[model samples]
Target: MVKGKLHSIETFGSVDGPGIRTVFFMQGCPARCLYCHNPDSWKMSDGRETDIDELLHRAKRGMPYYGNNGGVTFSGGEPMLQGEFLIEAMKRFKEVGINTAIDTSGTYYDKNTRGVIEQADLLLLDIKHTDSEKFTELTACKQDPLFKVIEDIKEFNKPIWIRQVIVPGINDSKEYIESLNEFIKDFKTVENIELLGYHKMAIDKYKKLGMEYKLDGVPEMGKEVMEELRALVRFPGKEMKKAC
Candidate 1:
């Protein structure tokens, strides 16, 4: 049985994908976003080992709540780290008639990983920063891999929900948002863009783990600023939900 290091599982996760769903927060991530809430998921060797059958069994229990829109979503610490493992699990989920989705940074795409990603029913792609230097600054990671994934997935015409963390001062400028909007035009499969406001909800989690919260003094992005950022994402007739 193929196993993956898992951080935790949310039996009834509503935010990861459409409808009510089972969300798996698998272990490991390549990026270190300044505002990451689940820093605990960064370490691959620390999480519990989970098997595909076990995850599917748990998913089965949530089938009733899944309704028509609900199903299974694989999130992380970057699920792409364990792409092949998830491919087998996702294939099983599909065999069982469950809708499959992946919440990924889209940076780990390759032949094997892309093959699995191609099989997902939906993709919740985290669009960190568009500017390569700024992207590296924000996530402490490169952007080329993610761009490649985006390019590769476009050929399949699969729906993708672009998720971006709107950090105040760092990426809230109108110019920056305009640039992002321009860049987003390249994606034909994007269903919508969800701009998440920055918050300090993870300070306590960082403190508990004996890690210094880098953005400790940073105030949460206020409603007014969020609204301003929200206004810039509108693309004529394109479907979108702003300032989430």
Candidate 2:
């Protein structure tokens, strides 16, 4: 029986992937990201054990809502942390004529993780920071693995949607966007770039979980600034669409 540590499920998610989809928040993560909202999902033991068959049934039930562009997305604490289960589950979902996607931190890689990424139809990659020093400071993990994953994604020619959380004082500059533009210039598979406005909504979650909220004093990024940042991401010749 192929089983996965399941944190939670969103039956109709619009943001994670194309159209409306079933989003699975799988358990466990290697990176201790400072801005992580789901502190509770860090432990693999805390998640419920879910059988692949059962998950397939649940996805099938939502087929009506998931039109052509929509299907299933395996999101996480880091979906690749449970690589074996993800590979199998993705396979099962695809067998049933469902398109599959993965929302990953791109921080873990192995044979299983490679297989998982290769199997996915679409990928939502979270870029914590473009600068190596800042990336390590923010996630408390080396950035090499993420680059390695991106290399593999390039090798496999996988379509990717890049997402980044824009912190007010930290990376809210045209310089940062320019660097990001350079960083993604080589990625022919990039579909769009989504700049998420940093918010303090997770402070309550951290408090309830008895964890320190690192960005407690940082004010949320407003719509005006977000729009400004979005505008800057549209470089002269690049066709990438700016998303919030």
Tens-digit lDDT track of model 2 for 54-143? 889989988998888999999989998888888888888888898999998877777787898899999899998999999988888889
**What's each prediction's clash count?**
0, 0
Give the worst 10-residue stretch by lDDT in candidate 2. Answer: 234-243
Candidate 1 backbone collisions, by pair: none
Model 1, 1-244: lDDT tens digits are: 7889999999889888889999999999888989998999998988899998889899999999999988999999989888889889988998989999889886566566777668898889898888989888888988888887777578777788888888877887788778878877777777768888999999999989999888878888888988888888855246556556
- Per-candidate TM equals 0.94, 0.95
Clashing pairs in 2: none
Q: Report how far residue 20 has shifted in candidate 2, in Å.
A: 0.4
Best-fitting candidate, measured by lDDT? 2
Q: What TM-score should be assigned to candidate 2? A: 0.95
- Give the C-alpha miss distance for residue 133 in model 1, angstroms: 0.4
What is residue 35's positional error in candidate 1, in angstroms? Answer: 0.6
Best by TM-score: 2
